[model samples]
Target chain A: MSERVKVTIDGISVEVEQGTTILNAARLIGGEIVPPAMCYYSKLEGSGGKCRTCLVKVSKGSEKDPRPMPKLVASCRTTVMEGMEVQNITSPEVKEARKGVVELLLINHPLDCPVCDQAGECHLQDLSYEHGSAATRYEFDRRSFERRDIGDKIQLHMTRCILCYRCVYVADQITDRREHGVLGRGDAAEISTYIEKAIENDFSGNVIDVCPVGALTDRTFRFKNRVWFTKPVDAHCNCDKCSGKVTLWYKGEDVIRVTARKDEYGEVESFICNDCRFEKKKTSDWVIEGPRKISKHSVISANHYEQLAPPPVIRKNPALKEANKEQFERVIRY
Target chain B: MESLSNRKKVLEQKPMTFGEKIYLPSIAKGLAITFKHIFKKRETIFYPEQERPVSENWRGLHSLKRDEQGRERCTACGLCALACPAEAITMTAAERKKGEEGLYREEKYAAVYEINMLRCIFCGLCEEACPKEAIYLDGPFLEADYLRKDFIFGKDKLVEEPLKS
Candidate 1:
């Protein structure tokens, strides 16, 4: 239990525990408002305010005498002060600024939404709907970069990078096994490997989640299906022993995708190792296409499969038939 | 004879016709040529959105090589920097110590290798110059920025994982 703080966001009054961020408190009194958090990992300690996506407006500041708090702040980093009022970052100017930032990111972006696996569920796409311009202003040619195979497990599209240090920051801060880091500066600065090494962490797949866009995607799920068609059903992960809640993406009878479900425990509290999160590969019942057949033995074509049966059991003499063996043995023994 | 040739040009040039004087037909021909080029297969690869295909010998974004055991193969012999014509490459070599056997496959390695992106013309000189095929320029050519400092690509960007068979 902690001290309670009362705050109003868009005329909705709510009381929340102290030390909770504006993002957490807003969740208490549900609203349609959404905060943008870049370079802020809920799991990484002291990892907020890097990209400043979670900006909010505080109308009344102090407990005694309240004035409007700073119109802008990194909500993921800022804690709830007593009697403070938050706007939930819905200002028109804020929208324009965020749009500008996203535009800058898209300037060099390959915009391969059709081919990318994370198109629909991507945070970058979500933000664009709420905070982006209609058209881009970059008249010049964009920066083109080929696919970089940083690790065997992960493929990095350098052109898709927004210069957010979340991947490397989380890698160094939380993973303790840093296989990635930012290289170069400004537009040239990108997420890459240390001397072309494979990212061999047990939890490397989380990079796919931390990435706001499809810059990082599971090599296993490449070009499988569009993300929009699947349904995210909340479930528990059965990887090892960790009971991290996971969302199973359902398309028809199949589970196409699996991801770490966000929870009340926060990103840090929910400790899911790399091996546990590999459940993303867990697929469900498939809807068979074309002619389906059941065969008992070997198949014919080049696409044939063979099924083998168990060998016959060995037999041994059971008790020498009957009592006739006993009588014969008695004579020999005597 | 040169004076007679120069004077002979004026004799044939008599009067300008209506279509020739208007210059409309010639302008239309020029416009058609421009339109043909617009629809034609452009040699320009839109860049950031579309990358140009790399020739087999084309040097691109540098990537340090790895051995079969997943160890770096750079001996850091300063050969690449020496061969660079633009002198864009700079390196600081260090001798391998005892326990770093798994870290670096080779004995000598670059402590620091940087290429000034602004100065580099992608001539592939540095790559051709290297005794060991450590530095390559195959891809991920970055976008142009408003600032000069952003173009300085460091070792972190240059490093890449080994190609899968």
Candidate 2:
């Protein structure tokens, strides 16, 4: 039996397992310190340590010790110790560090949110809004790549990619068959298929969901409707490969898109197969279990069903009227 | 005083001569002028079938335009709606899905575009505000409709047909 370790996150004390990461320990306290994680997913194996947005300062050591760590450690990868003290939520230095990391990640990202399908539901977009700079200091040309079809269903836009590598990890760990991996190096590193082979995996569609940005988008749902406009309904189907609990995005009467239904903590229960994500779009294919409650930040729910106010009546300027009257008097005198 | 005397002089009528008193020559002269028009080209046109030539700058009924590639030029940015003085234009934007590149010029397309013809003063402000060159006021005059609902021009009537390649 593992012993529970007491960890303090932003003054909130949470007792978690001995090997629990500092990120998970903070999450146990509920909203006390939500370190912005782009590359860390709990379900996927070997998922943390990338995307250094979750750095936290350990002010105090475990119960047996009193000394603190010399440097800030990545909370997503660092396991918690008993009586450890972490500063994530109320730290000025951590916030500034996160801002710098987010800025660097956005240096090569293209400004194509208006056309990107993932704009409303993107992790990078949300993180940037919370901790990113509006203006970039990098004045040089941004990297651009030709959009390619990775498989029959997935379209990859490399320009908007932040290289979080979540999709690569998901494909390797979740799916039974892996067809693609990250290729090249440093600034030119990209997710690519072997010898330009089209990804024909059954769970190929999950890569789009794993992508934090618009780098990987569904070809079927591409440019169809924004995520905020479509209402998400929890649904299920009896598929052989996996449990078909998914979210169907309904726009009017038609099912415009489909995605994995995330839990209250915004984590997908399981990676949905390609058939459920792309093939099964009909409303009758799955049983509907009411509408998913949209978050306050959702662009669709905010803009959807909004009755536009009629344009305000434009009143004629009094100065123009006076000028016209003067001109009329002058004409009469002439 | 001078202006009043001038007004009185202008009101005074000159006496007619013996030939003019009969009014036959004057009446004949008027009749001759009227008769001259009978032999000249007719000014009035036949209704329904014939149409008068409209001026080049005439702002008539609105029609949407198509690009050279036959794709719709409108991205549904709503600039025209903001610029409309009459508030006749209303539209909703939707993303242009995959395989719809041939239909829309951009990723954002107008899903529901309607213009209330009754409210539209044909001021051509919408045309001027259109950044896509998608809308213009060059179509034929709006035909009379029996119902009020028919006056509301939807995308079905406004969007131009794709130019055949």
Q: Estimate each model's TM-score.
A: 0.51, 0.68
Which TM-score values does chain B get in all models? 0.68, 0.77
Instruction: Give model 2's TM-score versus the native structure.
Output: 0.68
lDDT of 1 by residue, B1-165 (tens): 567556556457679899899999999999999999987887877777886677687656666666676666666554455456677776655656789997676545666768888778888876675655666777766667888877777777776664466
True contacts kept of each: 0.00, 0.21
Supply DockQ values for each candidate. 0.01, 0.12
Docking category for candidate 2?
Answer: incorrect
Q: lDDT score, residue B7, model 1? A: 52
- Candidate 1: which stretches are off by over 4 Å? A69-71, A231-238, A250-256, A262-334, B1-165
Best by TM-score: 2
Candidate 2, residues B123-151, lDDT tens digits: the string is 88888877678899988888898999999
